[model samples]
Target: MGMQTTPMIEMDFAVIKEDFSRYLIHDGAILKVKIVVKKILRTAELTAQGYPAGTSIDSVNAVAAIVPQALKREPSKEPWDPRRDVGEEVKFEPQEEKWQEYMTTEGYRILIKPVLTKVFRYNKYNDYGEPIYSAVIQSITNIEKLGTTATT
Candidate 1:
């Protein structure tokens, strides 16, 4: 007869910042300012990847139990904390742009860009061997700046 092993659970969360701001400077002077306003969303999920068929409800509950704690554990608030963040991925997109007479008076136009960044760290290790190695399947999303502000 074959032996059965307890299913393993993996949990992770994403940090979403819909609103943020940055600065735009020209000739050491402020031109215009941009403000971002959105909801901050944080989400998490738990799963047992290799669980066999007919898995008991209790097993699922057990896995879900850790979600609360995981959700509460927000990735380090410090955006560049080396201890927690290993690397980063950045994406920039022009969401909208407008050139108004009022804005032109300020000597610059208002440009709003959506910036999405993903921060992550290696969680799984290959083995305790000479050269340590790790891998990651899903990464945590970190929203930092939503908009830019500059004065002229």
Candidate 2:
């Protein structure tokens, strides 16, 4: 018999909201911030994924492999304020190359690709005494940033 392959299914999603945050790295010497675009799966895709009707399933593109540089920075002595240190809104848009791209108001650009990961509930076991696994779009991989790199 020939090998079986799962059919590809298109995922329909809608942008729900966006959030930004700043973090200190390298012993507080380097500052980083990233835009988290929240998206919810539509009815069709949700049903295809075996979710019940009216089930709310949300995902974000900010869960990437590489973190983006902060568009704005504050003095180390000053407490970090997200409103002032995170900079402008960044929009994540899908590209034809199968990679997602977003541009900061400062003209910096970041590229990322979606990754599907399987998660198992260790606490919950199946009748066969095996861990139950489910696939989820919880992160993105292969992140690349273009434009003037920030050093702050």
What TM-score goes with each of the models?
A: 0.19, 0.23
lDDT (C-alpha, whole model) for all candidates: 0.24, 0.32
Q: Which window of ten consecutive residues has the lowest lDDT sum in model 2?
A: 24-33
The prediction achieving the highest TM-score against the true structure is 2
In model 2, where do residues sit more than 4 Å from their true spots?
1-36, 39-97, 119-134, 141-152
Colliding pairs, model 2: none
Candidate 2 lDDT tens digits, 16-105: 223322222222212112334443222333244233233222334342122223322222444334334433222222221234554433
lDDT of 1 by residue, 48-133 (tens): 43212221111100000111222233333233434554543222232322211112121222222322232122222212211111
Model 1: residue 4 alpha-carbon error in angstroms:
72
